[model samples]
Target: MSRIFVIRHSIFAQIVVWAIITAATITFGLWVLTNATIQRTNRQALERAVGVDLAGMVDIYASGDKDELAKRIGDRLALQQRDGDVAHYLLADAQGARIAGDLIRWPGLHAGTSESADIYIDGTNRAFARSTQLAPNLRLLVAHEYRDLGLLLRQVALVFLTGGVLAMLAVALGGWTAAHRLAGRLERINAAFRQPDDAALEELARGSAGHDEIDELASHSGNALARLKRLAASHRATSDHVAHEMRTPLMHLDNRLVKALAATPDAETAARIADARTEIRGIIRMLESLLDIAASEARRGDRHGLAPVDLSALAARLGELYADSAEESGHVLQLDIEPEVTIDGEEMQLTRLITNLLDNAFKFVPPGGTVRLKLRKGPRLVVSDDGPGIPEDQRESIFEKFSRGKSCFGTEGAGLGLALCRAIAERHHLEIALAPTDGGASFTVTPEFQR
Candidate 1:
């Protein structure tokens, strides 16, 4: 039963039902008023007819012609069948004995004033009676059939029912249409809130602006998404900061241990210590790079205060710095930079970004391979290497924090370099992309970024 109620009492159905009820109430009220007015008008007309008949009867009595008066009154009433309910009349004497007409006996007629009552003739036909004095010793009685008013009332009720039914149907249809329209809008709002993820939420928010309830719902959803994004960013930043800060002391300890191990005198013991120190140094370096990445990310907000920095000069410096290391490792480091190309950014961070890219390229390139750094006035920087290039699928994943391609599994460095480069590029609003190369990977950084 509860389930049935739920099915039947939908918003549209409820609206239609209420509308029908209201329409029925109005129709019934009008019907009652109409019937009362009609009955009142008919009653007034009947009263006037009775007065005229009484006057005529009194005139006949004054002329001492009772028989003629009775016949005339009966003929007059039979001809005037306007309602067909008008009472028949009879003349009676002071002793309550009927003198003429169809009345069998006069039953206790009142004096000095008119009296009305229901009467029956032959114990069958029902009628309404009114009696009045015709003279000092005579009276006139009139009767109308009770069924006449019943017939009039039945006709009025039939008309009222037909009209009321039609009006109720119209009202129900209109109300249902209005309620369904409102429900549809609410359903859309509910669907928007049911989005599965943030991207879906953002898309829904973009589509939900208008001068209605749906618009209000969309605006609220957008605000909630924005707050969630801010909270996630804040949490990430805090985690990075804590990890970076904790690594500094560990790095210092590892550096001290390395120096102590280098000065030991026992050959076998020294060899073992040296190996341990090397592992510690690797850990130290990884920690330092992690700290650098965190610090760079922290200072990202200050990128807007950057002045113009020369990319060519920066590239030349890196080339000179890495040239001897490349020579020792049997690889060539080349620079092909145009002079005076400038960009707005923190010079220190850009230098670090370029240095990391070059270091990464050199690590993958084999002996006799070339690592080229090119800076041009197209206001762009390009770094490329003739080495085993990153696989197509791994290129995008490599830019994420701690993500490394299969080729770099045994490499000495943590995989924060490219991630830091991406962070820096984002901070400076520069466009960074990997260009597809046949033999090796190439990367280009545009001076101005647009999203």
Candidate 2:
């Protein structure tokens, strides 16, 4: 597996990314809502101030004192300047010209009408104001300038922007911390199974001290792997016991049959003894095949005691050894063994796998047939024989133990050849399948999930 795939596909990675996105979305939404609320409140406050001050101006106008109102405006302006406060005012005459205020000109043509208008200062409307006619010849206006409110809004925006950025950074840092820690621990668990050695499993054992879900998972997995190891050991011991108890008796019976054949000189009786010896030999071979199958099955998925084996050299050597037999049987044996086709495996078992397939090929293939042993760069091994092809019906069962229904030319076999071959292939994490062929049978061996 690629390291990139392992890291990027982690569940923690997805959670981390989603957390950061959600945090940013919420931060921006709250910032917009808060800014809008503050602006609304500030605008309402300015409107209230203008309304109250305008009402007071109406009281002054009702008193019917022109000098007093003018003096009040002058005093208010002086007080604002002294206190560094900003306010706009316009007390225009009925002729649409400034009379007693700092407004550069009358906002628009006016008379006894009382309404609202923009307070223009130096040719720019800077405030909203209300106007009223005071005794037909004078008008009063109290303006609410927006200069201070704008400065306050900008200050609020700067504070919000800075806080939002800090909040997002804090969220990202926390998410990254969580993702990195969780992903690193889970990756160690995955590595334990990929390589499956004691050193690899140490992380899982160490995780038992923690109280998180991953620790619980690690504890359970370690127990399960330990149990599997025990089961495999027991299975191997049983297989060895059966081989020992059965092979010795069978070998002794074969020796007795051989002696009987030698002592019995009568032609008819000697043939009978020889036939018995052949039966004993067949039984012994069957027992050995059964032992091989059991042993391979017991050790399936185990990587202990495995080492690099050169398939190219093994296949070439076997082909050379079988060359004379192919010539004697008048068959063509072709070897297309590419050099340096290597993989991690047990050399002895791989040898048995290749020889078993070749034995079956030689057994069923007639004279002048072609038997090919091919070893390719993918560590792909293929043994093909141009004999009578397997029937579609028998293809599924042929690899099963004692399935000799497809045994050609009445050949005698215990039918464990292909079954043993499959066991050996699976023991090494290789797949052996009867590949599609127009004639005869082709067995291909390749790694699972090759890419």
Candidate 3:
């Protein structure tokens, strides 16, 4: 599959293969056209020469001069072995007997029927034969050896074939080199945009001096990156200001509720005040979750300030830390973490992501149930709990901000645990997905494949 992808999709391979195919197609077309033209012209010349020679033979036999049929026969037979003498002749009697000729037998010879044919006197030589009846008892055959012309044509074909191959090779080499350079430039542009940081955008802007289509694309990308940075910063600031402004007032309201509860000795009024305080805390939790979600979303794919984290050791430590809580809740905690698993990521954010997932699992899992955490060499992290799994119908929606699954209904969370997990995964160039399980909820985390 990877090989097919390279051949079918990679820019360098595509261009080289396409160029070679086009070059070979044109080369073969020229060879066929040129060969046909040469064959047609040569055939016409041979027919004309044969017609003239037969006429000259008949005129000699009828001239009332010395019967020169045998003399012309002798003339050709003597010259048959010469390099320039490409003619073959035979003077045969009416009794179907050859008097003189190189051919052993006639090849469907007749009078006034001229067409091109490959008449082989032996195995190696080829000629076109023409014959006529001059005297009632005398018949003559004239054949022109075009073997030299055929040899020349073969040589020409060899030249065309070799030239075509060489031309295709040259095109492939040149196209591959050109495509390689072009692809590298394109990849640099893509990599810069992937991170969308100030340094990457600055580098992209600096490299646009070439002024080609690629450089033009880089220039546009740099502009987009700048705009993105500005927008993200603005949105982050606005969210922070709103959260701070609202939180201060909410805290003051909570204090007033506390004072009202203290002042009112009536049990019913105190219950109402406590309920208000609970609602206030819930609102605060929701606001904090929203802020975290916003920040993670804005930082998606940002590699700035990331450090290598030992994921295996981290998972182990987290698992050991949760063991006490699991024992207190009468639930089992299992860890199957691979050793030395590591990735480049924000450690605090990643810790929050894992903690959220584990906390979610522990919240839903019943007493005496098992919650398992596994980490593999792929940096794949999976946390599963033996509890009522999420309904398939609500799985997709559960990843939306403030959207909760059927199993999470009335749960203490702000319904943003899974959403925040997804956001944090995206920030670290990872993926978070709900995996199907027989009788439990299972969440898997791994590197995301863009394609």
Q: How does each model score on lDDT?
A: 0.74, 0.79, 0.83
Model 1: how far is 135 from its true place, Å? 2.8
Per-residue CA lDDT of model 2 for 281-367, tens digit only, reads: 788889888988988887776677789998888888999999999999898999999999998899999999999899889888888
Task: Write the residue-wise lDDT of candidate 3 on 337-441 in tens digits.
Answer: 999999999888889999999998988887888999999987899999989878778788878887765443355566898899999999999999888889888
Listed in order, each prediction's TM-score against the native is 0.45, 0.66, 0.81
**Positional deviation of residue 273's Cα in model 1 after best superposition, in angstroms:** 28
Where model 1 places Cα greater than 4 Å from the true spot, the runs are 1-12, 63-68, 74-86, 107-109, 121-124, 146-155, 196-210, 221-451
Greater-lDDT candidate between 1 and 3: 3
Candidate 2 lDDT (Cα, 0 to 1): 0.79
Output the lDDT of residue 437, model 2.
91
Instruction: Extract clashing residue pairs from model 1.
Output: 87-143, 87-144
User: RMSD in angstroms, candidate 2?
Assistant: 7.0
Model 3 global lDDT (CA atoms, 0 to 1): 0.83
